[model samples]
Target chain A: MKINRREFVKRMSAGAAVTALAGCMSNAGRPAAGRVVVIGAGYAGATAAKYIRLWAPDIDVTLVERDAEFISCPLSNLVLGGSKTIRDMTVGYGGLAKYGVKLMRDDAVAVDPVKREVRLASGASLQYDRLVVAPGVDVQYDTLPGLASADAQSKVLHAWKAGAQTVALRKQLETMRDGGVYAVHIPKAPYRCPPGPYERACQVAHYFKTAKPKSKVLILDANEDVVSKKGLFMAAWNGPYKGIVEYRPNSELEDVDASTLTAKLQFGSVNADVLNVIPPQRAGNIALVTGLITANNRWCGVNWQTMESIKVPGVHVLGDATLSAQLMPKSGHMANQHAKVCAAAIIAMIKHEPVNQEPMMVNTCYSFIDDKNVVHVASVHAYDASEKTMLPIKGAGGLSDKANELEGTYALSWAKNIWADMLG
Target chain B: MAVAVGCPLNAHAQDANSIRGMAATCANCHGTEGRSAGTVPGLAGVDKTQIVQQMQDFKTGKRASTIMQQLARGFTDAQIEQIAAWFSAQKK
Candidate 1:
C-alpha cells in the first residue's frame, strides 16, 4: 500500500495522540518530556541519539558507549586481507557531539525498565524519559565446548567486532607458513551478516593466494549452502581462488582444541594452523539482564514500527539484538535504517503525535571477493499491514550481476558515504 | 480547477516534516538536503516531474543503475511522488 505522509499523519494522529496522551497521564500526569538515554553507541544507538537531537532539539539525548572510538564491521574483512587497516576503519565520537548528542564513555551495566534508569559501571545512574538500546550481538562461546576457556577463545579469534581481534587475526594470517591450512568455522543461519563468513573466506583466500601462495583456506559452514549472494560467491570460489579455498557445508562445530588448533565438527575434525571460529550468537547480554528478551527467543522482541520493547514500556531495542522480521540481516546498514525508524517514532511519541504506521527501510550489503572484486545484496523492506511484519518489496532488490571491480569501487564508496551519514 | 479528494494543495508543516523523515534515507547517497557533492546528481531544485520520471525509470528496467534501480523499486508510486516533491522543493 502507498503511504503518503500527509494522509498517514491525518489517519493516525487522532488515535495515536489519544493513546500517547493516556499513557503519559498514567505515567507522569503530563506529556512525555526530559532526557533520552541511549545505550551502546553503535550504528543504531549513535544514529538514534543524533537524530533525536536534530529533530527535537529541546529534548536531551545522551549516548552511552564503552569505547570512545567506533570501529566499523563493514569494511573490516579488508583488514584481514591486508587491504585496509584498523585505523582506516576507526572513527571517533567527537563528530556526534556536533549534533548535540552527549557522549558518555562508560559501560551501562544494568537497566531498570520500571524506574527508567540505567546504572553504569562507574556507579552513576541515569534517568530517562525514553531509552534506546542498540547493543548489537554477543558471541556465545560457551555453546562450543572447548571454546569457553579463555586460552581457547584467545586462540580462536572471531574478530567479529572489528577491533583488536581483527588485528590479531590478521597477524595470524600473515604469519602462517606456506601450505598451512587456515580454517574458518561459520555458525548456522540468523547470524550477523549472512554473506560475512563467505566474504571472510574469500578475503583469507585472496591473502593466501597473494601473500602465502601455497597456503589453503578451508571453510567449515554449518548451513547446507552459502547463506547470501550464493551465486556470486560460488562463481568466485570456483573461478579465481579455485583449489585454494575449500568449502565443507553442514560441518557444525562441536568442539575446538586450541592447543592443536583443531575444530571438531559433527562428523569429523579439521586441523589448521589458524582457526577462526565465528561462534553461535545471541542478543547482547544487556537484553537478557534487563528482561527485554522475549520467551523462547535469544533476541529482544520489538514493535517493528516503533522499535519499542514488547515486554517493557519506555524502552526500545535496535540493531542485531532485535529479533527483526522480513529477513533483516544483522548488518550495519539495517541497524542504521532501524535507528531512523525508531528515532522518528520516539520523536512523534514524545511530541504527542502519531507515529508513522508505515516505515520503509533499506539494506545494502557489499562483500569483497578479493581486493578488487566485490559483490552485493540489496533489499527494500516496508511494514506489511496484514502480516504485521516487515517484508521485502517484491522485485525491488537483488544481488549484483556478478562480482566485479566496479562494484568493488562502489562498495568502498558506499562505506565512505554511510560512515559519513552516521558519524560525519 | 477542482481539488483532488486526497491530494491537498497546501500540506501541513508536520506533514512536510514527516516527508523529510522518509526522504532522509535518500540523503545517504543523494547528499544532505539533496545537494550532492559527488558524481551522483543532486535532486535539490530539480523539477518534480523530472525526478519522478527518473525514479520510475529506475524502478522499471528502462534506466539502469548500479544500485538506484533496486532502491527506487522499494517505494510505491505515491511515495515516489512525495520523495520527488520533497527534493524538488529543496534549495539547489
Candidate 2:
C-alpha cells in the first residue's frame, strides 16, 4: 500500500480533501470490553478468532477446538489425489496462545445458551459474555443407507474430514493398479466444497497423467455438472487424461455393496479398486441435537443481519451450519465473511451503540485445479430489502471460460498471496 | 480526533513482515481498522473483541481461507495479541 507514484499523490490529495470535508471526529473513546469465547476453529471460526485477537486485545479471548491440529478441507482434495501432503496442510494453534487467547483442547459437549456457558467433555464449563461458533460443516453419513462413520471411516475412505482419512485415501490411491478404475462418488447438495470432487479429479488426473496413464477415473456426480470451472477442468480432462477421466453426472449413488467393492448407482453398479465416497452432509451433530437446526437436520436459519439463531436468543451460528438466504454457497470464504459481519453486530451490542440492521457480505471461492491451474469465483453483494440477499454488483469476478496467460499467472499468484492472506 | 488509516505496521516488524503485516491485506478489502462499512466485512468490530481466538482458528488451519491462512502462519502468540489489540483499539 505504498503509494509513491504521481497517481498516488493525486489520490492522497483527494483523500486529504475528503478528510477535510468530514471533520476528523473519529473513534474518540475506549472500545467496549467483554470476554468472547469462540468455539470450533475452522475457516469461519478460526478467521473470526484470529481477527478478533488481532482487533481486540483487552477482551479476554478463549478458543476451544476439539482437535489439537487443524487440517483444511479447502486443499484437502489435493492430499487425497496426492498433489499435497498432510504435513504440508496441517496447522497448529500455538501462535494463538501468545496473542492472549486461552486455547482449550477439548470437545464442547454442550453449549448452554441460557447460562451462556459451554460444557466441555473434560467436565469443565467456561462462561462467555459473547460467543462465536464457526465449527465448519459436519457430514451426515447416516443419511446414506450404507456410509462410513467415525468408526468405519478407515475401512472405506471419505477423506472429507481431514486427518487419518486423508492418509488412508492416499494410501489406497497409491496401491491401486495402473489400469484400475478409480471411482469418486460425489453426494448431492449441502456438502462442503461442491467444486471439491472435480478438483480432486484434476489433482489425481495430474498424477495418473504421468504415473499411471493407463489407469482410469470414473466421477459419479449426482448433479448436472461439477460446479465452477467445469469447462476448464473438462478441457484438461480431454487434453491430458482423455481416456483416463470419465465424468458421469446426475448419477446418484445408492447403498455401497462393499462385498462387490462397487457403488450401487441408479444407472448401474460400477466396480472400482478404490471407492471415494462423499456422503451427504449436514450441520454438526451437536447443532442438530441441541436444537440449533430445523427438523430437516440440514441447517439453522438466521437473520442475515444478526446471524442470531432463529430458535434462540444470544445464539449466533455462522459458517456452513447456518442457513442464510444470501444464496452464498457453503465454503470457508463465505463463512469467514459472515462471521465478521455477525461479530460487528455483536460488538455494537456490547458498546450500546446503534447497530446497523443492514449489513453486506463478500465471498470469494478458489479451487486449485493443480499446482498451476486454478479457478476462482468472487462476488460483492448485500442483503436486499426483503431481508433476502443478492449480488448488488453482478459479475464483479468469476472464472474465465477460456484460460489465458494472465489469468493463469494471476490464479497462481492468487494462490500464493491468498495463503499469505489467510495463514501466511 | 484523528483515526488511524491502518494497523501500526512498524510496531513489531523486525521479526517477520509476513506475520505482522497479514491483517493489512484484509484492511485493503476490510477497512484500515477493519471497521468496514458493509462493502466486505468489518474485521475490527467483532472478532477482535474476542482476541487471539479467531487468530487461533487461522493458526490451527481449522480455518482455511487462502488469504487468511497464509496471513495467520509463522507468528508467535504474543504477536497475535499485539495485532488484535492494535485493531480492537479502533472505532467499530
My TM-score estimates for the predictions, one after another, are: 0.90, 0.74
Clashes of 1: 0
Please provide, for model 2 over A1-424, each residue's C-alpha lDDT reduced to its tens digit, 9 standing for 90 to 100.
Answer: 7767998989987786675446322221334577777888776666566655665566777778998776767777777656678877677766566567688898877888889888888999888877776666676566555555444555556778878888888888788889877888888775787677887887777777777778888898887777656777787778766888899989887777554567888777888888888787777766765578863768887777657777867767788888745446787667766666665656655544334444555555666666555666555555566745434445233444443444344443433333323333
Candidate maximizing DockQ? 1
DockQ of each: 0.30, 0.03
**CA error at residue B13 for candidate 1, angstroms:** 5.0
Q: Which stretches of candidate 1 lie over 4 Å from their true place?
A: A1-33, A295-297, B1-14, B35-47
Using lDDT, give the best candidate's number: 1
| Worst-scoring 10-residue span by lDDT in model 2 chain A | A23-32
Proportion of true contacts reproduced by candidate 2: 0.00
Q: State what share of the real interface contacts each candidate retains.
A: 0.30, 0.00
- TM-score of candidate 1 chain A against the true chain A: 0.92
DockQ of 1: 0.30
